[model samples]
Target: MDKKTENFLGIDVGGTHVKIGLVDTKGQILQFAKEITASLRENPLGFNLAFVEVVGKYLAKFPEVQHVGIGLPGLVSKDRTTTLEIPAISELNGFDLKSALLEKYPNTIFHLENDASAAAVGELHFGTGQTSQDYLFITLGTGIGSALILDGEVFKGVRGNAMEMGHMLSRGNSRLEPLIGRNGILKIAARMMDTFPEEVGQLAGQELGMHVLVGAASAGNSIALKTFAEVGEILGEAIVSTVRILDVNEIYFGGGISAALPYIMPSLDKTVHQYLSPYYLSDIKMQRATLENDAGTLGAAALCFMD
Candidate 1:
């Protein structure tokens, strides 16, 4: 196949698995595969070496692919040449990943980026009717990941790793992530059940999870509704501050927890409107991202288009 028309390889490196996809210019994934990181924890060559080797295998398997983009879950060097602090995969910390990959695959072009930023870039190209050049992208999953898109590009604040919303302090001086993240949301559900035992309904005495919480909310369970309300309030407050600093009006939410946007919207909207002035609230456009589950993979592939 002609290199000009060839597919690009996208690699989304997560804590547990590495999602690989063959993507085209239109953002459609032509092929996909996954590798479990857990199995490589004890590899004799070490996780870093094993990961590069796995990538090499994919490169060999798809000989037509000449461009590769990698989206990593944590901090990357300012120049996008190294993995700085990947909490989930400590083995990659301080590793010169870009150099290693280039050494092994000398003929290929590689682009490395923070996962959240990559997702924003992906949205820029693949999002449904998302033509806005300025917007804030937030991913709500194990942790809250964020990115800022300015002038059709991911804004890497002075340090390359700009939007770190997870660490932002919120109510009670606690970081935002632990308050509304998966475990935090579950904690709220559990607490709501204890506080309103009679109104708990489907959530009463059940194993707590995002699915259960969303299902209960869908079923009109009071406890579940209350849990989401709290989550929305906290998340919204953070957004208010973020918006104030960045002056961004368009916001996109993605990730697994975004599934409960309907339930959280009431509180989220209230909080934002209550805190922001008329100017900030008037033209605000907040909505869920069109590419939910595939954002990471597609976003990684989208990196190939960036300078």
Candidate 2:
């Protein structure tokens, strides 16, 4: 490696696994590793020890590394000293993580943030997001993760937990996470499969309600169209709401389930067009999130150079 390419380590700690990488300023990932473990994601002590073991092994090969950054599924406090509150990851509540990590490894600087926010910055630095002044990233996984960028900077809300669009109420019934998030799609599909029995929702994995709805749109299925209409309407309403509040024009989306975009976009656009003030929707553009799983790691890595 070139002397200038001395890299930073970016680690994405998700609910199911941890992804580690060595990334340089040029957006190249030189090495990557992933570990699957449930204990690592829940227990703060377990997570910390796992992190130290995994990261320490990787960094040992490159002795000169100066910085390390972590992207957690829940909220990373604004002060960078603690992992704040978030649903699902109940164990991390009020953990003063920065102090713990610093005490363990006194020689290196550490940066922490929510996984979606980290991915947003990663996209901003190395992906299509690099060109936009304002962009939002929504990752449709087991749950929903969202991030916002304004004036070319990642927008970390007051509590370091902003842009959580997934938890936003959709039908006044339950949160959006269960409706459109990765597992949410499966739940909808399973319910449809169980209730209706013969509908397309019976399809597996990414082939759930959203994909089925899109497939219906492609084949001119009215009922399928209605399904997307409902989801899109909800998403559109949310996007329009976001636009009014943030005035961001370009939004990028990606995740395991974004593959359903074929089904979701039409309704999403329709909802945005029908309900939002014409002024707001006129210039807004919706594009697929570019980096997928890589965004989080790269975004976490960006912390090494960003500030």
| Candidate No. with top lDDT | 1
Q: Candidate 2 lDDT, tens digit per residue, 130-166? A: 4575787777666778888877666877765689888
List the global CA lDDT of all models: 0.91, 0.72
lDDT for model 2: 0.72
Clash count, candidate 1: 0
Q: In TM-score terms, which candidate is top?
A: 1
Worst ten-residue run, lDDT, model 2?
Answer: 200-209
The alpha-carbon root-mean-square deviation between model 2 and the true structure, to one decimal in Å, is: 3.7
Residue 282 of model 1, lDDT score: 81
RMSD of 1: 1.4
Q: How high is each candidate's TM-score? A: 0.97, 0.84
Question: Candidate 1 lDDT, tens digit per residue, 1-307?
Answer: 3544768899999998999999998888999999998877678999899999999999999998888989998999999999999999999999999999999999999999999999988999888855599999999999999999999988889988899999999999999999999999999988877788889776666778889889989999899899999999999999999999999999999999999999998999999999999999888998999889999999999898887
Model 2 CA deviation exceeding 4 Å by range:
1-4, 39-45, 86-89, 190-229
